[model samples]
Each structure stands twice: as C-alpha cells, then as structure tokens.
Target: MRTIQLKKILNEHCIQFIEKKQMDLSLSIEDANSSLHSASNSTAGDKHDTSRAMMHLEIEKKSKQLNEVVQLKKLIPILIDNSQQKSFGVGTVVETNAGSFYMSFNAGKKEIEGQSFTFISLASPLAQAFKNNLNKKEFQFMQKTYTILKTF
Candidate 1:
C-alpha cells in the first residue's frame, strides 16, 4: 500500500482508539463522581467516608487517563506530515524483513488491504536504531538483522 494511504489508515485508527478511550474515561469519571456525591450524603459514618475516598481516587485515575488521551489526540497531526525524504522519519512507512511499520504512534498491529503493519512511535527503540543508521541496507537489533526492504 502507498505511504499516504497507510498513514491515513493509521491516523484514523489512532484517532478512533483515543476517542473511544476518552469516552470510556469520561463515563468512569461521571460514575465515580455520582457515587462520591451519593456517599457524601450517606448516614453510614466509616463506610461512607471510605467509599467517598475510593471514588475520589477512581476519579483522579480516570482524569489522568483522560488527560493522556487528549494529549495523544493533539500529537496525531504532528506526525502525519507527508514530507518527502529518502530515509526514515515521521510519516514514513517502512517495510523490513522484520515487519512493516508506520512511524507514527504506538497503536500496535494494524492490518490494511491484507497487509499487516505495526504502528510505532518515532521515539521507539527500533526507530531510533533506524535513525542512527539511515540509508543503511540492513541493521541489527537484539541479534536479529532486518533488511530495509522499502520506505515511503
């Protein structure tokens, strides 16, 4: 598949994943807040206090996750620039002996048009190795050498 097409697919998948995660986190936060409010009005002393505290913790956790999702959403477009480059960089789709990779985000395995591609962040170990050895025909990571089949 073409790099632009692959990038588009990965972008859509990443956005969908982050949005879905945000929705779930929002729901959890709402539920936790509701429980906390209810607990505040309860007559049960110790149990009510404990329940409210736990709900507060839960809200904090879910709020943190929601913040992360929002950050990820902001990061999506920065990596999708379709600049032309001979070597690997952000927005490039790489095919190697090891596997196909989209140097965009850590969205894991994505299958497009019958081909499997791993969506990885540019800061990933493998991508860092590739960065250091730009234009090299092959490179080794963890004792395994991967031939640079193509990059676009």
Candidate 2:
C-alpha cells in the first residue's frame, strides 16, 4: 500500500469532519442569535431576562466550539506533514499487531475500503510507544503485546 495514498484518504476524512463541524456550529450560532433577538422584544419580565441569559450562554458555548473546529482546520497540514518516513512520527503509517494507524489526529478508527485505519496523534500512548522503538519486533501496550510488522 502506498503511504501517500493512505495519507490522502486520511486527509480527506479529516476535511470532511471539519466541514461538518463548521456547518453544525454555524447553525447553532444562528439559532442562538435568533433566540436572543426574540428574548429582547419579549415582555415576560423575569422570565424574559432568564431566557436572554440562557441564550447568551448558548452563544458562548457555540463560539468556543467554533474556535476549536477552526484550530483543528489549521492543524490539518501540520498533522499530515510529508516528511521522510524514517521512524514512526508525523505523517508516517505504522503497521502493528494492534492495527494500521495513520499518525495524524485522534479522530478515532476510520475504515476505508474494508481496511481499518486508526488515526492517532503523535502524543498518543500508542504513538509514544512506537517513538524510539521504530523497527522493533514487539512492544507492550495496556498489558497487551503488539508486534511492529512494518512502518512507512
């Protein structure tokens, strides 16, 4: 399997996730704004004030989520760096007894063409284990032993 092709697939998945999250956050923010505007014109006294406060909280929460999604988008290129695959680092695909992993983001397991690829960050436990012991035959993780078959 080509590592470049695998990286492209993983990047596509990450982009799709970012797009979906952006759309969801946008909708949430719009809804919160609408509610806040409605609360402003209402004359329910204490109830209206409470509703306005709640809408403000919702907008704040959605704003934070949007910020996080934007940061993830910025990290995409850095996550999939096209560097030399000397050892298990960023942009490298590691094949182990546990599974095939694209060291990118912690987006969890992604199955493409019937094969499973667990996208993990370099700071993750599994990636840390594969750090210095690149070509080693076996290693232990969570009390379970795993063999490093190949890395690219």
Candidate 3:
C-alpha cells in the first residue's frame, strides 16, 4: 500500500488507541468516585479517611490523564491530515536507515498494509533528529548516524 493510505490507517489506529485510553480512564475515575462515596458514608474512622483521601487522589490523577488523552485525540488529525508536504513536516513519514517512523504520536508500532510504522512524537529524540534536519538527508542521534532514504 502507498504511504498515504498506510498513514491514514495508522492515524485511525491512533484514534482507536486514544479512545480506548480515554474510556478506561473515565471508568477508573467513576469507580474511584463510587468508592469515595462508599467510604464517606461509613462511620468516621482514621482508615476510612485515609481510604477516601487516596481515592480522591486517584480520581484526580485519572481525570487529568483523561483530559490529556482527549487533547491528544484532537491533535492526531491536525498533525496527520494527509496534506502534501514540500519537505518533511507533521503529516509526513521519514524513512531512514534505522527504521520507518510516522510523525504523529508515540503510539508504538503497527503493521498496516503489510508495512510496519512506528508512530513517534515530534519531541522524541529520533523525531527531533529528523525534524531538525528536514533539509539534509543525514543526521545523528544517540551516537548513530541516520540517513533519510525518503519521506512519505
């Protein structure tokens, strides 16, 4: 399959992943709230207070995580919008001597259309190397030199 098609598939996979994470975190927060309610209804006790406090912290943490996931889900399409690139940009994949990387999110590897693609954040060291050297075909990261064979 072409890189454009494969990138679209990768984008869909990333969306699915974000949705799953958001759902899981939401459920966790709900469960924690329920536990907190149950703990509060019980008689005042040191253990119960501590349990409630812990549940409150858990709920807060999960809610923050869910918010971050929602932002990331919104960003995926904007970053990988299938626009034509003059040089390597947000929606392009950089193929190097080391491996193939999708310039989207750090969603790990997925095999789509018989091609393996590693979704990486632009802030990542490897992606940074590519982003900085968009004009050049060669760059070094982690003591290894990577030569960009092509961009998709």
Candidate 4:
C-alpha cells in the first residue's frame, strides 16, 4: 500500500468516527435534557425520584462523551489533506518496506487494501521513534527495523 492511499483511508476513518461521536453526544444531550424536564414536572414520589436518578446518570455520561468528542475534533486539523508534501509528524502517512502505517495522532488502527496498518497516535511509542526523522530514515519498532520508504 502507498502512503497516499493509506492517508486517505485514515482520513475517512477519522471523519466517520468523529461523525458518530458527535451524533451520540447530541442524542445523549437531548435525552438528558428531556429527562431533567420530566423529572421537574413529575407529581412527586417514586416516578420523580427515578426520573431524577436517570437524568443524573444521563448528564454524567453525556458530559464525558462530549469531552471525548471535543478532544477528537481538535485532532481533525492535524490530518494532512494536501499530498504534495510529506513530513514526519502526526497525520502523515508513512510507507515502510514492511507495510504502510497511518499516523492519525488521534484515531487507532485502520485496515486498507488487505494490509493491516496500525493508525497510531502521535503520543504513541512507535511514533516517537520516527518523530523528528525525515524520509529515508530507519526506525526500529520492538525487535524489527523499518526503513521509511516515503511519507505523505
């Protein structure tokens, strides 16, 4: 697989995940707000208590998921859309003799064209190995050495 192709795949995956996260957050927020409204309007008794408890849980869960979605949104800008130039940073697709790897800086593994490539975060250990290196440099991962064939 080529670096450009791998990059396209990673970009698609990131977009899909972001969309799903956003949708989930929106739905959760709506549900939580509705639950709160219903709890407030309840006549009193077990129904009110149950609604209150459910609302609290929904709010907590939604808040956590919203935070995660925000973080993921921040990473969207890191992905390089221009394929003209290549760099040794997150969002850059790296090609090695062994296989292609997409450095998402946010997303996880994504398979492309029958090749199981690891879409690693920039903070990951393997990414650190090639952090500041340029194209044609050799990076060692675990016990294996991979030569940087190309970047895009």
- TM-score of every model? 0.83, 0.82, 0.88, 0.65
lDDT against true structure, model 1: 0.79
User: Candidate 1's residue-wise lDDT over 25-52, tens digit each?
Assistant: 9998998898888888889788788888
Question: Which parts of model 3 have CA positions greater than 4 angstroms off?
Answer: 80-83
Model 2 residue 125 CA deviation (Å) reads 2.9
6-123 per-residue lDDT for model 4 (tens digits): 5666777888878887898888788888879877886889868887888888788888878888887777765644433455666766667777776765555666767666677777
Error of 2 at 35 (Å): 1.9
Per-residue lDDT tens digits for candidate 2, residues 76-98, read 77756653456557777787888
Clash-forming residue pairs, model 4: none
Candidates sorted by TM-score, descending order?
3, 1, 2, 4
lDDT to native, each model: 0.79, 0.81, 0.81, 0.72
- What local lDDT score does residue 113 receive in model 1, on the 0 to 100 scale? 87
C-alpha-based local distance difference test score of model 3: 0.81
List ranges where model 1 is wrong by over 4 Å: 83-87
Best model number under TM-score: 3
**Residue 48, candidate 2: how far off, in angstroms?**
3.0
Query: Which of the predicted structures, 1 or 4, would earn the higher TM-score when compared with the native?
Result: 1
